[model samples]
Target chain A: MSGAAAFWRKYGVLFKSDWAIMMAYRSETLIWMVGAFVQPLVSLAVWVSLSGEGSIAGYTASDYVLYFTAVLVVDRLTRAWDVYELDRDIREGTFSAKLLRPFHPIHWSINGNIVYKTFFAMLMIPSWLLLAMFFPAMRIPVDMGTIGLVILAIALSSAIRFVIGYQFGLLAFWSNRATAMYALYEGIHMFLSGRIAPLSMFPDWVADAARVLPFYFTVAFPVDLLTGRLADEPETVWIGFAGQAGWLLLLALSLRFIWRNGLKRYGAAGG
Target chain B: MIHVEGLTKIYRVHVRQPGFVASLRSLFHREYREVAAVDGINFDIPEGQIVGFLGPNGAGKTTTMKLLTGLLHPTSGRIEVGGFVPFRQQNAFKKRVSLVMGQKSQLIWDIPASETFLIHKEIYEIPAASFKERIDYFTEMLDLSLIIDKPVRQLSLGERMKCELVAALLHRPDIVFLDEPTIGLDVNMQEALRRFIQSYNRDYKATILLTSHYMADVSALCERVLVINDGKLIYDGAISKLIDRFSPMKRITLVLGAKIDTSVVEAAVRNGGGRVVAYDYPQLEVEGPREEVTGLSAKLLTELPVIDLTIEDPSLESVIGLAYSEGAAGESRR
Candidate 1:
């Protein structure tokens, strides 16, 4: 078989195994999703109350609802817990099995997250639709071209965030404070990635920084693409795709760099 | 199938004293020292040979195993397993080798051992028919039919280890590294695992390198043993030869029916060219060279009111323990 086919074949088995594990902890998963939903839910409430049925900084109540719901779903789908997992694995020697595998450990981490997010989405989509029925503002603005571009953007966004989180997770090879490093990264990401507020609501400099930096490309840009923030200008939406692609390329390169160096350190540590 | 020449690994460790003041002081100027975990060890094993690596804790056995399996890189020298440089970690090289650490588990703890087997099947690309056949065979051989479907966390240590070995060998790797594969197992469990390992060697002709402090594991399975201490290879030869070289004394035990004077028993043993190593009225123990055991036993039988007597060679535990201390002392002096 070709290498690509072999990769997918292996991935299918890995995904199935992880899906079983997720299913066994279905209740715990629901509880965690409840916590995850609170962020976007509160953001929507605050924006709606402040807007008073009008527009706040070019965002209508309806726009705020759509943007925050999209953010919540996208964030859930792209979440990475590898920083803590890697830290614990390295310290406890659980990483030995992963390192001994013929494939890179990141593939396993990625596969596990894919299974978890797919399960979470399967559980959450119906609730999202029910909420949309109760509140018309929560309904998504869908189009064929927009859906195609948004799908590409979400895929790239997931890849970019996964690589970034994985690269930070590799810090555990050198120091015990890898989780702290990830938290610091997430602190910066929250403000710039529009996890706290939409990029349009940020100060002009912060918004521009989010655009030039990779943070907005991961969360806000994809959320905006889905909400038709770039609706009128098809060219701008395409440009956003190009920006996300560029960041994905950069993060992918860094992931490789971090992984090669991290393995050397990990091997030296005798795990 | 496996060869090593001057293989070495040195770990750079940071040293720190344990106080808040010392910790603060270390932040600016840290002290580092290089400890050689595997120091220039050399050995070779042809295909189908199961060589036991014997050592005390903190010796280089595990480090050498890790280096051979490409889990850790060597600082110097060369290692070739199945004609491939192990540290390169090439896909073909990896697929041909396997490692099993008794203290570490590769199975998914919350899932059945069979789940891990399926994952390995995908990773190794084992044929579907062969995977089924092997699973059935291993389940019967290891008596895992009842436990293979249970979650790993729910299994006993020995049962989990049984599952671990099956998972590792499912791919039929040509080069196997087993580090203390029966560390905490019962005697029966250890024997079962040893039989499986021996059978694997016989059938596949795979080069097997095993490390265990348990002397029974080495004596039962390996013909040639590698004794390492202080990160150096001290003795590499047959197990019997090691016993002969390091321990030549034989022990004899007697069960006296009536209480005998300790002095008389000691005197009788001394005159027979054996010393009373232990004595308690009705029981006496003597140690002597192999050549003197027969003469001494006969003399003790005739001279003392001995009810029954038995003789034995020195245990492997003593011979190996002596080898490690003597070898490590010698290596340090050099």
Candidate 2:
């Protein structure tokens, strides 16, 4: 086997190990799932009440339900916990052991995250089907072309989010409280990624700004693809993909830069 | 093989006083003190040799181990393990060496130690046949069959340590760096581990560098010991020579058959040019020069009803203590 093939083989083993670990904490996983679904559910309910007896901001109550539910599922599928893992490892000197290994630490962390998200998506599918059954507007246009693009967008978005979170996590090598910085980043992402409402609901300048930033590409762009918000506009779809690709490339470069600097700082900290 | 020259590690430790005001003041202007964790030191060990690194707490033993293992980069030094610079952490270099810290663990806490063993097999990319054979060998040697399947959190300290050793050695690396591997083990467990280490070294022809405060570990496993104090090498030679040079006085213990006057024995031993260190009902411990001890033992055998008697040198513990104190006093004068 080639080098990349061997790496994937090792990654497959790690994925299995992560699956077992996640299963061991099934109750905690369920609690996290509930927590995740509740946010979007609440947003959908509020929008439904706000659009009572008529459509508000060009979105019917059913549309609101579908959009928010899609957002919830997409968010759950793409969430990355690398920041927390990186912070803990750097702080406790656990990263020293990882550095001893042959492969880079990020590859293992990403594999573990992907495994966790895949399992989580399996659990979320039933809820997704149930929500779509009751709300006709929640139904996605299941064409092969759109489906392929959505899948590609999901892949790119996950990479972007993972690298972004990893870069923040690497700050622990230099900073005392890196988790606090991550919390700040999460706060900004909440509003910018349309977690509470669609980016269309924001003012023109704010929506334009969100479109230009990477946070929106993580959730809003994929949700747009699923909810038909970007339908009939191939240019917008291409732009979404381009933005994700650009951010992925930038974050990857930044992740490499921060990782090198962080390792140097870690060595200074006695590793 | 391992080589190190002029290895140095300096840490910028933040200094703060204990008060809210001090903490507030430190926000704007912080004080930093440079601590020399490892000063300039040079050593070389050939492959397959088990060398003991002896030192007191905070004497740069762990620091040196970390440096050699590439966990820490030296400020100004050159180190090579198996022809690869450790700090570079090349894949082939990492594959050939392993580091085991007794106080810290690499095993997954909520899972069985076997899981960690499997993970390490993957990480090291060991073949299935070789991995299985190595696991079987370690399991048998370390007596890990019973505890290997249990969750790491459920195992006793000694059991956990044994499992850790197996996990570390399963890869069968050519070089092993063990830092305080017998810190909290009971006597029997320590003996078992020491025996396993010796056998592993001999069987694999692996170079082993071990650091520990337990002198028994050094005495049993290492013929050549490197003693470090205050980030400096004080002595590097055979363990027996160290004991002999540091502890010139020999200790002779006698088991008396009958109750004897302590003062009489003490006076006689003093006159015979030996010092009576301790006296109990049936036993007496005397310390003196070798020749005087021999003569005094003969005199005591003639005088007292000696049921049993034995003469021995001071233990490694006392010898190292004396070495540290002497070294400390000498440094103070400088």
Candidate 3:
């Protein structure tokens, strides 16, 4: 087989092992799932209460439900905690094992992310279906074209988040408080990604700013695309895709730059 | 094969002092010290040779091992292991060598050893047939048939170490670096491991570099030993020569079948210009110049009612201790 084929075969094995380990942590998964679900659920409740009998900023109670549920799904699909995992590996000297291997250490995190997100999605989709069953207006149309676009957006969004998280993790090579930095990033992401409310409910300037920033692309843009916010505006939807691609490219470069420097620093420090 | 010259590693450690003032002051201005962990050590091992690296704690033995294994890049100097610069970590170089740190493990904690072995099989790209054959051979050799399938957390320390050796050697690397492979093991386990290492060396002709505080580990497997102390190599020669140079006196033990008077044994010992290092009841130990061992034994056999008298060199432990003290004294004088 060719080199790429061999690499993917190895990746398949890594996925199998990682999936097994994730399955072993059933209680932890449930807790994380609850944390994931509760945030969107609370957001939905707050937005619905604010809407009361009429639409708030063009988002009716049912539209708010659809948006937050999309937020829940998109957020879970794109979440990356590679920062914590990489931080622990670097701190505990376990990364030495990875360095000794022939392959790059990032492959392990990549495989883990795929396995974990797939498992979380498998668990969350049923609950989402159950929620939509009781709430008729919250249901999304089963349109194949829209589904394809949403999947593409979600893929790009996950890559962006993963690279950003990994770059933050590389900070551990120089600073002990990289996780604090990641928390700060998460705080900004929360405000900008429409986790509090739909961007349409925000002031005009804030909504415009969110559209231009990568955090919005990571969470809100994908949710909006799936919830039909971009359905009627073909040009705007294409612009959204361009923005996602732009940020993904930029973040991928930053990941490479930070990783190169981080490995140099690590080698210099004799880790 | 391994070649190293003037290999050095210096670690920059931040300095701090107690008290709130020092801590606050250190936020803006910090102090750092460059400590030389390995200072210009040099050695070369031809293919298929088992060379022992002997040193005390914090004596740069582990540092040298790390340098050789590419775990740490050297601050200065040169090192080539299996014909590749270790720090570059080229796949071809990594494929030919393995490192096993007794205190650290590469096996996954929550999984069975077989799972880890399979992972290694993929990483090393071992063929399925050879992988199975090697696993079966190693398991049978290490008596790990019962424990290979068990999670590593459940195995005893000895059993875990045995599995570790198997994991490391399964790829059949041409070079192996073992740092204290027998640490925390019982005598029987140590002996078993030593025997296995010797067998592997013989069968594969794999160049072995081992570091251990257990002198038995060195003496049993390494004919040539490199002694390092305080970040420098003090001696590198045959183990027998090391003993000969550091410990000039031979030891003779006597187990008398009948009760022999202490004075009678002492007189006979002194006749051969030997000193009685220890004497209690029927047991006696004599220390003397090497040349006199034959005559001393002769006199003891004839003069004393001895049932068993064995002549041997000083233990490797005492010889190594003497070598270290002598190196320290030399350092002071210099």
Off by over 4 Å in 3: A203-205, A267-271, B247-321, B328-334
Tens digit per residue, CA lDDT, model 2, B69-149 = 887778898999999998787889889888888888878887899988888888888889999999889888888889998
Better of 1 and 2 by lDDT: 1
Chain B TM-score for all candidates, comma-separated:
0.86, 0.85, 0.82
- The TM-scores, one per candidate, come to 0.90, 0.90, 0.87
User: Model 1 has how many clashing residue pairs?
Assistant: 0
Best by DockQ: 1
Interface DockQ of each model: 0.50, 0.45, 0.34
lDDT tens digits, residue span B192-270, model 3: 9999999999989999999887867888899998888778888887887777778899889988888777787789899
i-RMS for every candidate (Å) is 1.9, 2.2, 2.5
**What ranges in model 2 sit over 4 Å off?**
A267-271, B248-318, B328-334
Model 1 C-alpha lDDT per residue in residues A1-271, reported as the tens digit of each score: 6778777889999998898888888899889878988978888899889998689889888788788889998888877888889888876667878777777788899898888878877877788889999989888787777878777787788888888888777888788888998999898998899988888888999999988998888888788878877788778777788888898888888888887777666643332
Q: Is the docking of candidate 2 incorrect, acceptable, medium or high quality?
A: acceptable
For model 3, the TM-score of its B chain against the native B chain is: 0.82
> How well is each residue in A1-271 modelled by candidate 3, as lDDT tens digits?
6777778878887887777777778789889867877877898898899899899988989888888888989998998999998887776667777877777788988998999888887887787789788888768854779889889989999999999999989898877788999999998888888887888778989988888888688888888778888778888878889999999998888888898767655632222
Tens digits of per-residue lDDT, candidate 1, B120-151, equal: 98888888999999998898889998999998
TM-score of chain A of 1: 0.93
